[model samples]
Target: MKKIGIYLSFAALLLTVGCSDWTQMEPVDQQPVRPSEQNPELWAQYTAALRAYKAGSHTLVVASFENGSTNPRVRRTACAAFPTRWTPYR
Candidate 1:
């Protein structure tokens, strides 16, 4: 009876390990190129703005970001940052 139980447990373990569904797993989606590669101007603008902010030059960082890009998304995102990014201009 003990030998039969061991055989059944071994068969259950084998089935559990062997029956995993690899076909359902999908490959990772990869970016074709970095955003900077396609839009260097925007990337440079953001990088400079970030550095200016980190260097504690809060008032001047806004000027550096306003690069006159026609993209509304950039303008909107930057505008949204002003309220939180600054602290009473101390």
Candidate 2:
């Protein structure tokens, strides 16, 4: 009975280790998504903000998002997130 149990365990381990081909498996072919694809207006806002941010005026960048946004959270978030895109922290 002990020998039978050991053999069954070894067989199970072998079956698990040999279950899949390491090289022949296909890679996932998922395409990257851009904000422009889902919401062009939001993309435009982000790009405009990014351009403004690159030019060094942050106040106008945050204020540009004043009232046109339907979601207040995105407005507040964009205010916080844009400036941190470049950092030296030194």
TM-score quality measure for candidate 1? 0.30
Count of clashes in candidate 1: 0
Give the residue spans of candidate 2 off by over 4 A. Answer: 1-9, 16-18, 21-24, 57-90
Clashes of each: 0, 0
lDDT of each: 0.76, 0.76
Q: In model 1, where is the ten-residue run with the lowest total lDDT?
A: 58-67
For each candidate in turn, the TM-score is 0.30, 0.39
How much is 41 displaced in model 1, in angstroms? 0.4
lDDT value for model 1: 0.76
Off by over 4 Å in 1: 1-31, 57-90
